[model samples]
Target: MKISEIVTILDGVLVAGKDQMDREISFGFASDLMSDVLTLETNDLVLLTGLCNIQSIRTAEMSDIPCIIFVRRKKVTPEMIELAEESEITLIECNYSMFKTVVTLAEHGIRPLF
Candidate 1:
């Protein structure tokens, strides 16, 4: 699904990379553990996590995740947003909890099984 469709589905806030809104995302990975992210392998992964920090951005960069969803009303800092921007990663924030975020994406046909 396109990132724009995701934003519309989740009503997520686009904190950065507005241009990426139209980019196509093939799948998603919901994880808060960086180690878990390091182990998983996928292209165009849209990561969902409540850990809103620079580490999350770094993890996403290393894992090549195309976009990130800050779950459960977690707020992403300006520095993290800048880091994502530098890496050309799309950052999205939403009030939905982690479970809701994953379910919503799955319902929208953005499952991780790709």
Candidate 2:
């Protein structure tokens, strides 16, 4: 499914890259560790992190993650939103816990190993 489709599946808010919503997302990596992300296989990356801070967004950018989904209803700052906008990364906010979010996506055909 595409990022746009996932947004609908999860009832998430698109905070950035509205135009890129149609971009297909084959897989996602759910984590809060930036270093691990940097070292992992993350080409077609959709980041799911509970760290509701600018660093999360920055880490996504550094790892070339096309999407960032903030789990656990954590709200990101306006600055992070703007950064995501500038980076052209799709950002979504959802109230689901990280485990629930990951499981839900996996059950819906989005696997981390893709």
Candidate 3:
């Protein structure tokens, strides 16, 4: 699915990387742990996380995650957005809990990493 469609489905707001809204994402990896996020080796994956911080952005950069959906209504700070922008990672903010976000995306044909 496209990032734009995911934003609509999750009732999320695009906080950054508006140009990437058309990016295609096929896998959903939900995690609040940056360490766990670093273990992924896949393409076209979106990181669903509630840990809204610079670490999250750094981890995504290292893991090559193109998009990040902040769950549980967590807010992304300006610093986080700056780093995400530097890494060219799309940032999305949503109110859904992690589980609900995962279920919703899965229903929309986003495959799980496992």
Candidate 4:
């Protein structure tokens, strides 16, 4: 699915990387644990998490994740956004909980990373 479609599905706000809206995302990984995120081999994946820290952005950077969706209306810091921008990662904010976000993505044919 495209990042634009995911944003529409989740009623998300694109906080950064507007140019990457057309990027393809094949899998979704929902987690708050940076350790778990670091364990994955992510490519063309969108990370769905409530964690709004810079660490989350770093994890996405290390994992090569192209996009991240912050769930439950979590607030991302300016520093986090700056880091994500530097890494070329798209950041989105959604009002849904992590569970709802995952379900919505699945219904849209976006599979789990596992």
In terms of TM-score, the best-performing candidate is: 3
Question: What count of clashes does model 4 give?
Answer: 0
Model 1 TM? 0.95
- Writing each residue's lDDT as its tens digit, candidate 2 over 1-114 gives 899888887889887889898888888888888887778665686888888888888888877789999999988788998999998888899989999889889888897753
Taking all chains together, the TM-score of candidate 2 against the true structure is: 0.94
How well does each candidate superpose onto the true structure, as a TM-score? 0.95, 0.94, 0.97, 0.96
Candidate 4 lDDT score at position 62: 89
Model 1: per-residue Cα lDDT at residue 112 = 80
Worst 10 residues of 4 by lDDT: 36-45
Clashes of each: 0, 0, 0, 0
Clashing pairs in 2: none
lDDT of 3: 0.92
Identify the runs in model 4 with alpha carbons over 4 angstroms from their true place: none
Q: Kindly report which residue stretches of model 3 are placed more than 4 angstroms away from their true locations once superposed.
A: none
Give one digit per residue, the lDDT tens place, for model 1 in 1-114: 999888889999999888778899978898889898888778677989998889999998898888999999999899998999999899999999899999999988887843
Task: Looking at model 3, report the run of 10 residues with the lowest lDDT sum.
Answer: 35-44
Whichever of 3 and 4 has more lDDT, that candidate is 3
RMSD of each: 1.2, 1.3, 0.7, 0.8
- When sorted by lDDT, best at the front, the candidate numbers are 3, 4, 1, 2
